[model samples]
Target: MEGVAAHQKRKVMVVADPTRESAAALEYALSHAILETDTIILLHVENPNAWKNPIGSLFKWPSLPSSSKVASSPSSEGLGNGAASLGYAGGGGGGEMEFLEALKRACEIAQPKSSVQTERVAIMDGKDKAPIILSHCATLGIDLLIVGQKRTLSNAILGHKRSGSLRGLDTAEYLIENSKCTCVGVQRKGQNAGYILNTKTQKNFWLLA
Candidate 1:
C-alpha cells in the first residue's frame, strides 16, 4: 500500500482554505512533520466567480510603496519572532491574496529550523475539488494529506459535546475515505493548542504548547 511504502523524500499536501482552521492545519503539519526534508504542497481551489471581475483592477498586483512610505510606517521587528513579510505580488484575483497570505504565514512558521521545500498551487475550479486533490496526490506520490476541519452550522447546532472526536469537513472526509495516502485532520483547540485527529480511526490527540 502507498501508506506503508518507504520513500527517501516524503511529499505532504495541505488543502489550504482561507480560514483559521486551515492555518492551524498548516502550522501543525509544518511544525510536527517527522522529516525535515519533506516537500509541503499548499493547494488552493479557486472559485469560478472570482474571475468575473475586470483583470486590470481586480487581478493586477498592487505596486510596492515608495521608500518614504516604508520609512514612515512603524517597524514590524517587534511583531513576533517570524512575522510574515508581505511585499511580493501574487497571481490570480482578489481571493488569491488570501491563499498567498496563508502560504506566507505557513512559511514563516516553518522558518530557520525546517529545510522542507515548499510549493503552492492554485487550481481553477472547473470541476470538483476532491477529484483534483486525489489526482494530485497520485501524480505527486503524496505520502500524507493534511487538512483543517472547519466547524459548520450543523456542527455548531449539534455541538462536539460528546468529546470523542469532531467530524471533519466534506473535503477532508472525502480525501480521508478515498485518497491513496494517509490523511490527517487538524482542528484548533482554543487559543494555544491544536488537536490532531486521525481520519481512519477518528481518534483525537492533543498537541499543547
Candidate 2:
C-alpha cells in the first residue's frame, strides 16, 4: 500500500483557464490529491489576442505603433503596471486575489504531506496551447494532468470544447487510451464533486471538504 500510494504521487499539472470552475477544480485537486507528486505546476496563459479591440481596425494609420510601444512609454508604463496588478480577495493581492487565496489554502493543506512541491506559472502570451502544455509537462517529467471537465449534455456528447482539452484531441485521446499515467477530469454537481476516469485509473474519488 505504501508503494502503491507512492507511485500514485505522480507529478500533476493543471492548466489554468480564466474560468472560475477551472480554477476551483485546480484548487481542489491540488489540496485533495496531488500533494505527493514530484511537483504541481499551476499554468495560467493570458492571450493578448483575446484583448484586441475591433475599433483599432477602423483606422489604417501610416505609422501604426505596437502595444509594446504604448506599454513601454514612461507615461503609459504606470498604467500598464497598474492594469497588470494582481488582485486578491481580501483587498490585498490585487486581481489574482481569489487565485492566490486558493493557492494559499492548498499550500496550507499540503504542508502536512511531504510528497510534492507546488509552483505557479503565469504565461503572458502562448499561441499554441497543446504543444506548449505538453512541452512543459515533458520538461517537468509530469506523470499526470488533472483538469476540470465541464459537465453538460453537450460536452458529454461532443466532448471538451477546447478542441484538445489537455493534450491535443488526438494526443489526449491517445493518452486516455495508452499513457501509463492517469488523467482525471472533475465535474461539479452542486456542492459535490463528480469525476470521469479518462484513463485506466480510478474513477469518482469524492472530496470531503
Instruction: Give the alpha carbon lDDT tens digit for every residue of 20-122 in model 2.
Output: 4454455456445554444566665445556645452232111111222333444443333221222223223333444434443343333334343445443
User: What do the candidate models score in CA lDDT, each in turn?
Assistant: 0.55, 0.46
Candidate 2 stretches with Cα past 4 Å from truth are: 1-9, 35-38, 52-105, 114-126, 158-181, 200-209
User: Which residue pairs show collisions in model 1?
Assistant: none
Model 1 bad stretches (over 4 Å): 1-7, 50-98, 101-126, 152-169
TM-score result, candidate 2: 0.53
Query: Lowest summed-lDDT stretch of 10 residues in model 2?
Result: 59-68
Model 1 worst lDDT run, 10 consecutive residues? 62-71
* Model 1 lDDT at residue 99: 41
lDDT of 1 by residue, 1-209 (tens): 23533445677888765455676676666556534456667777666566543332322221111221222345433323221233222334444334456364435444323334444555565666777788888987888999887655533353333322223446665666677788887776775544556465554556663
Task: List pairs with backbone clashes in candidate 2.
Answer: 86-94, 86-95, 87-94, 87-95, 87-96, 87-97, 88-94, 88-97, 89-97
